[model samples]
Target: MFRRLEEGDPAVRTLWSQLVEISLQEMFGIFDRLGGVTLDYPKDGEAFYQPYLGEVIAEAKEQGVARQSDGALIIEVPGEETPLLLLKSNGTTTYATRDLAQVRYRAQTFHPAKILYCVANEQALHFRQYHAAARRLGFVPDSLELVHVKFGLMRGAEGKLSTRRGTSIFLQDVMDEAVRRAREVVEAKNPELSDREKTEIAEVVGIGALKYFDLSHDRRHDIVFDWDRMLSLKGDSAPYLQYSYVRAVQILAKVGTVNFPLDKWKGESGRFGVGLPEDVQRLVRELARFPLVLERAAADYTPHTIAQYLNDLAGQFSQFYECYPVLKAEGEDRAIRLAIVAGVANVLRRGLDLLGIKVLERM
Candidate 1:
């Protein structure tokens, strides 16, 4: 089929174009369902770079970065026993040809400081070779950073989920189940909420729970997919943080504190009251660390850093809430405690947003 398409067969080209259109549309729908971004760029599929394979090979050969190994065109990376194969012995292009073409195209077109590839750990060695090849071929400058952000698999009861093993879980199936379970929990918690409200809240909680379950774990470690633990309101999950945010928001609402600006208590111009209780002080300190946590998370591209910090912050807030009285306190004590709770809610909302999780006003 690919050969027919390459041969300029009209029927094959029409069918291939139709398939690409359908696939892109389906991908957009899925991203919408997940409440994720639909990138604002033209599609750059393999077909777009298919014509560049010859140029990529010719340039690599011209630069002496690529050589033939028993009739297979390959690039030798230092310290690696296996060379990167661009073309097989049968004169057919391998994935390395397409990927290297992509790297070259993106580097020239986008001029990005770093091109990060978020892929499974299995491609680690492939990336190492291609990155070296890109540098050696002068396709990209030494200043251009190529980062391979490798992550582990989504494991199930049968180990790593795979279509061949009949253990693969479709993403839509998981998302639908998450929302269904979330709806049930919502009904149990707040039966008074209208169906529309429950559904809206469920979507937020369900997607947030699913994203957090994966994001909370280290990217290097495989996570056991379990819904019970993921949506547990009191456990280390997105629902836990969402519920905690709702609790804080409810307190502020009950106290008629509609606008609790975090800037009043954060940054260099921030001020605080004297002689706050130990628990309140601890909560304040945790809130203050949000900036540092965000910095580390961004710099390392490790979302677990933010997730872990949010978990710790929620725990400290829980401790403070149980031991203090926000609605019943007086004067300076009441003001400071409300500020702390508001800060907690704010950070939870922001942190969860960073993790692509949404917080609920009520859960």
Candidate 2:
């Protein structure tokens, strides 16, 4: 991809590179604000991997696994009636050939237990053919797993967003629009806040709202982008979670110097003589399950599970906050309730961090 881009006309390539850099800068800025980190590109791997393309194709042809279909080179994969084309009739390489070489290079270099390709569902057959061809050519071992983690499309209001149709929205525009709408909401809700505070809050809310909306949905299902729904505070949205976090912070602030004795609440039934409220217990139980939720999400390679869990945790904490009065309660009761509130805040912050969403101290 980089080679093709670099091989284009100098003026066109420079313009394209500038546009890509601008998009990347905007994207990275948003990510940084949301407490996310960026990864470094593997620059040295290009030299090592580039030579495998021709080698793999030559081996395929030499082994009789790749044959000529008309003027194009093709491989007949098992369980599929149609042959996978490796090269065009014009003697140009196809994506399948490049993919087969890439996969073989990865397997030889990394020897990883599993190689997961997170791609759209539309390219399912392409990956299948690549995997099958690589195995048949002895480039990939049978023991090494090559899995495709297919995701669904993200559509706009009218239909699938396409650049050719001129309906494709740029990342900068989306971020700007979200922040702009968020500023309006913040201004209306908290008119007394200073400009700087409002701007900061708007940024956090806007970016968080956008990220939560994406991560909350099942990856295999198509999601429609709706501004009103994404920025909403009522339903299972980022604003709702932020509001819950703020409520917890407010409760903690009311009880000035109260200490949360986590040691006292080590077990399900703590030393507190009074029985805890059901809502408080529910919040505690949900907080306890965060580790399991994190593990499951990592195993399945789905951040939506973590997003869903955080939303549920936020809802549980909201109910507990509404039902119980922490500052007004006496002695052990107050301590227990404060501990629960602290736990909720901690879990909520950590969960949001996992989803690359920022938390607002005040919203």
Per-candidate TM-scores read 0.93, 0.86
Badly placed stretches (over 4 Å) of model 2 are 1-37, 43-49, 254-274
Candidate 1 clashes between residue pairs 3 or more apart in a chain or in different chains: none
Cα distance off (Å), candidate 2, residue 285: 1.5
RMSD of 2: 3.7
Candidate 1, residue 62: the lDDT equals 87
How much RMSD separates candidate 1 from the native structure? 2.5
Worst 10-residue lDDT window for candidate 2 reads 41-50
How well is each residue in 314-354 modelled by candidate 2, as lDDT tens digits? 88777777888788889877778888888888888888888
Q: Model 2 misses residue 262 by how many Å?
A: 7.2
Candidate-wise lDDT, in order: 0.85, 0.80
**In candidate 2, how many Å is residue 168 off?**
1.7
The best candidate by lDDT is 1
